[model samples]
Target: MRLRRSARIRGPGGSFLRRPPLRVNVASPIELRPSPDGRFLACGDQVGWLRERGYGVDSDGCRALELYEALYLVERGDAAALGADGAPLDVSGLISLGSKRNPRFLTKYIVYRDLRNRGYVVREGYGLGNDLRVYRRGEYGSRDARYLVVALEEGRRMSASTLGRIYLRALNLGKELVLAVVESHGDVIYYSVSQFNLRRRLDDAA
Candidate 1:
C-alpha cells in the first residue's frame, strides 16, 4: 500500500499537529488460507495486491504471507485469513494463533506495529537473525532492506555473545542491526548496533 505523505493538521487547541503517513486502503479484503506447512498463510486470490504491499512470497502460484504479515493484516482489517476452522480471525484470535506458533509473538508484534506506524515497510527476516527486515519508505523495490531488526522487552537479559553474533551477522550481510526494545507501558526504543575492529598497537622495542 502506498503511504500518504506526512501533513500538518490543526488540533483542538489550534496547534498544528503532524500526521504520520497513512496507508492506502485495500480495494477489498483479501482471502488467506492456512498452509499445510504451518509456517505461512497462503492467499489463492488477490496475491498481486498482497505482493504489491510487500506482504508475502510467491510459491508456485500462491502468495504465502508470513505469520507476522497475516497478523498485521488482520489488525488493519485488510484481510481475513482463515483459521484452522476456515473462519476469519480477529486481531486477538490471530494473536493467539501466533503466540501458540511462536512464543515471542507479543514482543515481536509490539515492535512490528511500531515500525509500520513509522512508515517503514517490514517483512519477515528469515535467515537474517532478526525478527523483521525493514525497507525505508519509498525504497522497497528500488533498494534492499536498510535494517534488520530484533525485538526485546525492556530490561530483558541477553547474553553478550548472542548480541555479538547478531552484530557479526549483520556486518557480514551489509545490513544495519536495530534492536527494538518494548517497555512495560508499550513504548519502544530503538538501538543501532554495529561492529568496530581496532588494530592492536605494536609495543615499542624494549
Candidate 2:
C-alpha cells in the first residue's frame, strides 16, 4: 500500500489549486447552509476549494454558492446542502427548492453542469437577461468572460427579435452569445449566435 505524502488536490478540474481540498475521501460530506433568505448556500470561507474554481459569490467574508453550484457539489459527493431544520437535502430535494428560487434553475443547472464538464468556468449572469456567463476555458477569475449563455429546453422556440436582441446585448458587452439547449436525455447542444444584418449586407452588395 502507498500513501500520498501531500494532501494537495485540484478540485474537479480546478486551476488555482493552492491548498488541500475541502474534503478528500472523507466519510461525511461537508455541511453547507443556506442564506437567511434561502437564496444562496454558504459554508464560510473555508470553501476556498470552490472559490479557486469560480463557484461562489463572496459576501461578508463568506462565499455563498448559487443553487446550481451547491447542487453540483452535492452530486459530486463533496458537500451537502442543509435545510433550515439542519437536515441534509438530497439532490432531488435541492432541485425542488431551487425551482422555487428560480423556475429555470433545473435548466440552468443542466447547462452549468455541461459547461463545467467540458472545462469552462461558468458564472451567474444578470442585466443582459442572460442565464449564465462562460469564461474561456482556463481563463476564469483572471480574464473577462468570453460568452453570455442562455439555456433553454429542447424544442423551445424563440422569436428572431428576442434572440437578436440578446445577441446585440452580448455584442455591446463585448461578448459572444451562446445558446445551450438541453434535450430530454440530458444532452446539451450549443449554438453560437451573432447579429448579422442581412438587409445591410444586401444593400451594400447591390
Best by TM-score: 1
Off by over 4 Å in 1: 1-24, 39-45, 127-130, 196-206
What C-alpha lDDT, on a 0 to 100 scale, does residue 7 get in candidate 1?
A: 30
lDDT of each: 0.69, 0.70
Best model number under lDDT:
2
**Clash count, one per candidate:** 0, 0
Cα TM-score per model: 0.78, 0.78
Model 1 clash pairs are: none
- Writing each residue's lDDT as its tens digit, candidate 2 over 39-104 gives 455555356666888878777767788778888777677787888888878777887888787676
Local error of candidate 1 at residue 197 (angstroms): 12
User: How close to the true structure is residue 199 of candidate 1, measured as C-alpha lDDT?
Assistant: 13
Candidate 1 residue-wise lDDT at 86? 78
